[model samples]
Target chain A: MNAGRPTGTRLHWWWVVGAAVVLVAAIIAGVMIGAVRLSPSQVVGSMLDRLPFVDLDTGLTVRQEAIVWQIRMPRVILAVVVGSMLSAAGAAYQGVFRNPLADPYLLGAGAGAGLGATLAIAYGPNTGDWLVDPIPLAAFAGALIGVSFAYLLGYTVRSGRTSVTLILAGVAVAAFLTALQTFIQQRESETLREVYGWILGSLNTAGWAEVRLVAPYVVVGLGVVFAGRRLLDVLSVGDTDASTLGVRPGRIRLVIVIFATLGTAAVVAVTGLIGFVGIIVPHTVRLLTSASYRVIVPLSILLGGAFLVLADIIARTAVAPAEIPIGVVTAIFGAPFFAMILRTSKAVVS
Target chain B: MSTVRFEKVSVDYGAGPVVSDVSLGAIAGEWLAIVGPNGAGKSSLLRTAVAAVEFTGSVMVDGRLTTTLTDKERARLVAYVSQRPRYPQGMAVFDYVLLGRTPYMGTLASESTHDIALVWEALSALRLEAFASRDVATLSGGETQRVSLARVIAQRAAILVLDEATASLDVSAQHEVLEVIDALRSSHNITVVSAIHDLTAAAQFCNSVAIMDRGLLVNHGAPVDVLTESVLQEVFDPSIRVLEVNGDPVIVSLRSEEAYQ
Candidate 1:
């Protein structure tokens, strides 16, 4: 036992610092090593030139500038934002449910997004421009609708919004939504490949607009979750104990679910249903740090961003010129890691 | 000087009242033990003080009606430790105890230095300082009970409501825990209201005892007055015998005559 402070608290700060350093290194690597390999100086010079008041000339050609700015940068940024959102949302879900197996998609967000994307591809007006894409908006609406329907079902059945009932409701809602999506896909076989590709999850079409679309929701949602960290800790003691400790566990759980769903829905809307990051990042963070939400939430954000960026790098480089879907990459590694966690760690869903 | 009073408190779970018209009070610095057999509503009555379950009548903490107070205000006045409370996996003992300081923290803030110091004090009080960094999920039944007690001690509330807080502990650990609580009541004047199953331990530790049967308060007074042989026979078992041991009541259950035959 360390004097002056709890050992968990001391070690958490070190994890945060280490995660931050790794994230920065991953970002630099993501910028430099892409389809077109650029030197470190070229990547740095291009980024500096794009900064508001900086006019640095490193004699890089226009093609090089477009490759760095227009292609790689937006994809990297989108990966970071999406990964952070999913992992933080997962951490919040686990805390609220008091189950480590709980993930962001436990509330039917993925199925809803799938249905929304299917509908958009099947019947949405053909717009050639990527900026005016209707898939993300439709997917976002569908995700919200799916989660709301599940919440309403759970609320009506239990009258108390207990976590177990809510999860069961979500499972039912997801199955129904997936069946509807399948029917839609069958009716419009022309868009089958498009729907399947989107469902498999890819970051190939990522651009600045997708980044802008998801930023505000992720920022606000993360803020809400961070603010409720202490309450989450109290909630883990069970509802009655939390109530006696001055926390309204029901209200805190609801607020956390809403914000986590919103952030997760926003990212899944653009990135498609990227699996594993949500479950893997938060669980890994808990292993590295204590189970306290105060440490888990921030570290989830940092390490999650780095994990996805690294995954994307491998997705693109492993079979170069023919990029593998990112969801496949995450599952390839996440499945074994998750199984190992279940076998060895006692700090899982209880 | 904080007092907890229940004015005709009744709790219902849709069918009917589990605890009916129960009126009780615990004075400042008093150790009052509520004793009864299973389904006697002892736990329900204790829970009413913390508003854990919805109740019909009023519970006043210190002079204010508990219904009128905010959750935070009510929490600052009373802390409840439930029987068999759930522990989060991988939570450290120190962190679990520090959660008791939730009432004292701001909405977006963490525990203060003073709060951490109180947690340390609580841990040391229960002799749990050595296990401060250990995972709560990894503790034994008795150690977990002590950790639960340490958490409420860190809460620093004027009144503590424990629902069978020591049911899991062995004989010696139970004595050690009750000793710590007795020390707290005398030195800090903290009022403790616990739902206890062990009659002899309750008689030894508590200054006053309340007897309940079938959702009603049958009798309440000093332990010697309430825990009589006749009352034990009626409320618990017909074969129970109450004897005096060092001026405190000790209850023993005699084997039935049919079993001997």
Candidate 2:
């Protein structure tokens, strides 16, 4: 047992540690390199002084402090949280299905969230009241709707026997949701730009309220996944094999699907469906490490958070005066890197 | 401690019957070899007992109808080890074998210290300790057979059903696997049921044999009686010569008309 622990296990831990370090650096870079440039030391000092009972002697103007503490910090933290949730959910989906191609978006979370945001923006009172964050609320509802349709259609066809039929059902549901969201956008000339910009994905208006609202759901979903890590390992073998091990593969799969959807929904609600982070980060982590759920689960979480933070930094600093859509930056980097990984790694697709 | 019985069981897979009116029983500590030609429903019979395939008539494990118990309960009593398992690449040998313990684990239950220890012991016993961290896809045919056997053994099941498990191995590897099966049957008192094509090897290991032809069980008896020349000719459709060397029956196929000329 001890002998078995050395070879692949050490490499997984190293990768996780490396990903964590990079995430911290990315967060710092994200805060330091925004439009009104602040040094890393100043950002750090400002943050430390803001914390209760930790008075570091760093004098700063109100504008610098607000930009660093209120704007960039919450936004960066939100990006990390959302990224970690989506990637970890993707890992859970892949592990449950035993298919490397599985992602949270494939299940209708993104589409549902899109519809939710559109309805809130197009129909809600135009006063911009703090109480009505339509996008996140709509996203949460849309995610639930999407997953329900996916599950309903999937179960209707095969009774939850194979992953193939389920994934296909997800594809159909995603297409349907996308079509609905497009129709809604096309009909409303007033809400078209708002819908388009939100769909492009952003962390611009993220605040403590958004962070607090989405964090609990994502954390709970992740907790459920972590607690069921061993079960996911059994699932990686396939349903029949998992059943022989004393797990009801269908029931366990349903649980995972629901939890993963919940996590993805939480993030999509706040950030309006950031794509590629879920698909790329988990696959990259799996390649760097073996397919053990124990290792992959936590590593995907940390690496995913780091990847999003780094991407957010690039989004803010790439064009000096104007910030690019975080989603655009993520896709540009994630697509090429994902292709390279796919070309090189022997990823098993069933 | 209870025996398994298949009474007038017939399995059909959207076609006509694959296994027709098959009645067989495996008592505790008995090694029963189901011998037959290819496509003769040998695999179907084993799968029916494991409740993997639908079948008419009764299939009982531990005196209870297999259909009555949950899938998990049936698995605990009778474990099926498929031939040439299709595995995702990069799966370590230890993890693959550890799946056998799934029947004993709860859905949310963590793999306890005991489960890990059992997996280690199984690996050592199969002499796969050295290859624990190696990818299962990289294993040779013989090594794969041993690893699968180790998994079944880890299942700690009362009844074991193997479907041409050693068919991919070399001659010596075949004997080694049979030897391991013999040890498992004798030591653990597991009711061993295997579908073997090699008549001589089947005769050497099994106390009882059931011959299957075209989805029908043609004959079943002790090895000496069921393995006679007439039965061999009818089932195998070959004029085989049987010789007794050191009181053990060894079957040799006679040359065909073209080869003989």
Candidate 3:
């Protein structure tokens, strides 16, 4: 699925290493050449000086260090975390749901975050303290609440916690949240531009505080997901067959849904709703490399992180100071990429 | 001996009871085929053995209640091949068969060297080693079914269960798969319980046949005894015929379109 024809075989280790290099290069590029262009040698040398027993120097001042570490590093790291998380979550969701179209936000992450962010924009106090910011906190709470309700509804439905039921429940909850978000946007048209920016998504607000806020959830969620990767492969074989193989499909789904949504919701809380990384990256990895989740999940993480960070570089640089929403950048790239995959891969449905 | 037994097992999937109080057993190393018309609950009955469906009563493999066993323990005892095997898109055939080691792996663990070796052995056993590196989706129906069997063989489960394992294949492929299964059963001394749609194939390979009619097991005996005219006419259409070939009973595999004809 490496975003094209899927008539392929095993994912090579070299490709994974290549993806890692891409991520590292993207990070290096993203850190340098921003609004205030900084020297790469000085930045890299200063970072190497901090390493234990290894020393290096290329003459850096305190001001540049602040710009690199405080502003750029956190922002790039956030992009890596958010990007890798979304892609991994998306791949996990697709495997659990067995639908290539499934994504990290398939179960209420986007809509819930939208409604919360909208509410904060329209009526919340303009607190200077980013620590207690109502916007991200509200978004986080809203996302968790929305997914919980979806799970509950799907579980209680006549047939019970089938993937279809969970998906339908997600759709319903998302619809309701999106409707509420729209109403808020309409009633407070004065803040429509602010709301629109948040909806379109950007990493402009990324800082150490935002990173700290999302780190725990993302870490725990991704750990659970990575651990369950093999189970996901088993679950892809359908519930009955997976059960016959001694996999508890229902339990595994619940665990994955809870954790993957947690990670997606955490990132959405901070980054707003960036799209395409979730849907495009995983399938692309699957097609290009291997269908095995063992390969897909890990590769999706690296490539997804690299892809978004590079997209972020383009986003901030393309228009020169008038930054396009990072979501817009991803969509510009992801839409055509998605189409190519659809055209070339007959195995998407299989 | 490791065996499978269902003691008064009944399955009800909300609409109604699909299988009702089925009491049956398969001895170790024996192939017991469940034969019935569509809707006679063969699938549902098989589902209980794998714990794929909710059911009342007991399904015991190797004298232990399947419900009481851990997932790993149950997996070690029984392996199943579905009627419609999900050929996960773009998955290498070797990787697909490696999934059979799920029970042996830690939750977060990748397959070990031993696991890889077993997969190779399974692939060779099924005559599928050549296709190991190929995508599972590229295989023909017969080859895909063999891949499925190889996965189960790698599982090392003492009991093997299949549902219409060869229904999708041509005659040659059907025998090709059945022969491998027969070889597995005889060589490994594995217990096999399969719901077979092909009556002749069922009669040819199975040690005994259990005939189901509307969720009840009405007859259970050797193929020669159970494939008689009286049983065939009662369970299937009256036009259904059975004949002897080289001392082996073969169902005609068809019903006369018109009773007059």
Predicted model with the maximum TM-score: 1
| Residue A78 local lDDT, model 1 | 90
Per-residue accuracy of model 2 over B1-261 as CA lDDT, tens digit each: 858888999988766999999998888888889998899999889888776667899988888998898867877888777765656576788777777887777766655667677777777777888888888778888888888887888788889888898888899999998998898788778898999889999899998999998888899889988898888987787778788988888988887889867
- Each model: TM-score of chain B? 0.97, 0.96, 0.97
Write down the RMSD of candidate 1 (Cα, Å). 2.2
Order the candidate numbers by TM-score, best to worst. 1, 3, 2
**RMSD (Å) of each candidate, 1 decimal:** 2.2, 3.6, 3.6
Kindly report which residue pairs in candidate 1 clash with one another: none
Separate clash counts for every candidate: 0, 8, 8
Model 2 spans with C-alpha error above 4 angstroms: A1-17, A46-55, A115-131, A158-160, A183-192, A338-350, B7-21, B37-39, B54-76, B213-216, B232-261
The A-chain TM-scores of all the candidates are 0.92, 0.91, 0.92
Residue B15 lDDT in candidate 2:
68
Clashing pairs in 3: A1-A284, A1-A286, A1-A287, A1-A288, A2-A284, A2-A287, A2-A288, A3-A284
The native-contact fraction of candidate 3 is: 0.64
Candidate that beats the other on DockQ, 2 or 3, i.e. the better one: 3
DockQ of each: 0.70, 0.40, 0.50
lDDT of each residue in A1-350, candidate 1, tens digit only: 33655633543557878999988778879988976788878777777787899999967788887887788889998999988989999989989988777888888898999999999999998846656688988889999999999888988984565778889999999999999999999999999999998988888989998899899999988888878777788889988899999888888888999999999899988889899898899888787566888888889899889988988998899999898999999899777976787678656545
> lDDT tens string, model 1, B79-121?
9989889888888899899888888888888777788889998
Q: Give the DockQ ranking, best first.
A: 1, 3, 2
Task: Supply candidate 2's per-residue lDDT for A28.
Answer: 81
